[model samples]
Target: MPKLRKAQVMILDGILSILMAMTISYVLFAAWPQHRETTGQLALERAGYDIVNAFYEDKEIYQTIRKGFEAKGYLSASEVEYLRTRLYNYGRMLGVSRIDVDIEGSEQFSVEVTHSTPARREQFTLIMPLRGGADDRIIRVSLWE
Candidate 1:
């Protein structure tokens, strides 16, 4: 069964449609799970501006993170519970699985982080196949005295 010669089947169907679109765009932007999410809000605004410039620069962030969260009690540093648990555990190490914050202004206080799924115009389709695009990453932080 060797009767194929229409220019070798149009150059092997254009090289199998460009190697199947580069193997489905490298498995939808590198390995599954409808990912990216605005690079997790630019790594949570660069670790919340280096933790609000290490809490107003130099030192004294609520007495140095309230003496390391009251020596690891996690709460009860005379009040404000270690500055709202360091503004939500530094907004969950920057990935911010989900968050809804509002500090209502102060020496500077405001934050909002919400990301749980590919909701910002979802696009997905993967595994053994070919399509996926996603977005949903919000990070905002402003912490001070």
Candidate 2:
């Protein structure tokens, strides 16, 4: 085979470099959105856990829940409403998009509170048991965008 001319070799090298750059760009563009989505989902999960911990840790919130549990074996409508408001406010302060709370024991109650328009499809749930209860009452906190 004849040796390649310098000009032809340089042209081939330029084309190869261009193709490599395009391939790299395409891979980065394809993977970036997925990485961002995974990060968002992780943040939501952490927010859900924090919300549950906040409820259990705060004296006022803990007392409110305990009062409801002791009084009627379930949360009263007003108590539930208060909790919805309080939780929604707290979640908003933390930049959470939407929150749904579910309490289940002998009865099941649920509340959905939205701080803003729901945009994301991913959801994170935190399940926690109420303390000092003879019944197995579980509180489920769900956070989503």
Candidate 3:
């Protein structure tokens, strides 16, 4: 084996000293507990996205939206009620205090279903097209605790 130069030896010693110091400090102080707030926010956002996708994919919801678009300018009372019920049920299933669904379509037609006033903190909003193809209708789902 080639003999290490003095400079190489000094560098290796410095690296080893740093490693030892780090190990000792870790052993004495222990590992810090990671904060989960960011993780929770990501999960909340994911749930909101899933809810919006469900709304986009559901056949009944699609039919209602399509009919409303084809018919008189906006959704009927029954259709609005159906959407509200669905959003409320989803909120309950997710164990969130409130969930809001806002539907906006072309021609300035909009419908909103809000169960309760949200705290505004720890909320996630997801927006997606109402139908699969190029559709004027878009849905926004907000989930908050």
Candidate 4:
């Protein structure tokens, strides 16, 4: 075998390094969508959690639901309507057009606050305890863009 000149060896190393960098860049670019999807899912999950937390944190809303539970074992029609309106407004503020809320207690009640023209593919759910209730009542909030 013939020994290569110093310049030729350097050129070969440079070419190899460039190829390695390009491969790495391509891999990262190819994986970008997956990373974005994961981030989007996380944001949706956070938004769901925030919406549920908002319901819990607001004294008026909390009292209304608790009052409903006290008056009737489950939410009344009026109370459900109020929730629907509030959720719809909140969804608009969050830039999420589709939201579904399910309250499970003595009876299972489901309500769709805002309807998306074209259904969203991504969704996130948050399950929270209904405070001030004797029984184990849970509110499930599902959000989609």
Candidate 5:
């Protein structure tokens, strides 16, 4: 190869550096899933789901986490209201601030969740029936906004 001139070398180096920086940044930030922007809304969603998984969905034994989320600091009444509004009755599906089973699993076993404020929303979850056995959430929704 021919020896490169100083100006050409500097230009190539600049382009390479910019590309490397962009690639590094994308890799670093893209690894983890997204978190909600507003703390209150996020807190409400986390608190609701956490409450369920901690309290009712336990396949294993552990110290109760109910009271902690119920405490005034971790969650607020608005959050409670938000959760209440989001939950739906059996055999009902809606996205107007509600949960929906957007997808099903093979053998007709699956889980569904929905959040209306943004768009369809979902979470990666493990579900254990109250009686016995365990199920995994297959299809999860995401907020569009």
Candidate 6:
């Protein structure tokens, strides 16, 4: 009778161990895709911020914006083209399929370029003062992957 009881106890232990292993496997597999998607979104967010920051820190961009502000609240066609081209190049370098930039200063400027299909998208906005902090401007960049 003692031996019989021992056999039953061993079988119960084995069954419990198998159940635990199955539970662990299910949890890991179920969460794997969510984890991957979260990481991808984080990367896209970082990229969007980088694009916005580039425009903020660029001397040429500042110069162009200053020129617009000085010109009675409007940017010239050439200045707009220059900004559009620069944004397109940045999008290309970052492997993005589309880029949209919105600049709000003394005037509003918008530019967009679409090159391919998009699988993900992220946007970032920055506010910076122009011309010695006398005026503030908003720049928003959206990147599509």
Task: Give TM-scores for every candidate, taking all chains together and pairing residue i with residue i.
Answer: 0.25, 0.63, 0.57, 0.59, 0.26, 0.64
lDDT of 2 by residue, 1-145 (tens): 2456877888999999998887898787753324333577677667766787787787777777778877777777788777777876777766677676666652333344554577664434444445544555556666666
Top model number, TM-score: 6
- Number of the top lDDT candidate: 6
Error of model 1, residue 89, in angstroms: 11
Please give the CA lDDT of all the candidate structures.
0.43, 0.66, 0.62, 0.65, 0.38, 0.73
Candidate 1 runs further than 4 Å off = 1-45, 56-60, 64-82, 85-95, 98-145
Model 3: per-residue Cα lDDT over 48-120, one tens digit each = 7666766667777667767776666577877877766766666666656666556675322222334555544
Ranking by TM-score: 6, 2, 4, 3, 5, 1
Question: Candidate 4: global Cα-lDDT?
Answer: 0.65
Compared with the true structure, what per-residue lDDT tens digits does model 1 show for residues 36-116? 555644555565565555444534444543343345533233434445556566555644443332221122233344434
Model 2 gets an lDDT of 0.66
CA lDDT of 72 in candidate 5?
28
lDDT-sorted candidate list, best first: 6, 2, 4, 3, 1, 5
Worst 10 residues of 2 by lDDT: 30-39
User: Model 2: which residue pairs collide?
Assistant: none
2 versus 6: better TM-score goes to: 6
How much is the lDDT of residue 9 in candidate 4? 88
In the range 1-145, model 6's lDDT, one tens digit per residue, is 9999999999999999998887897787753334333477776777787787777777677678778776667778788888777777777676677777677753444444554567877878887676677777777777787
Clashing pairs in 1: none
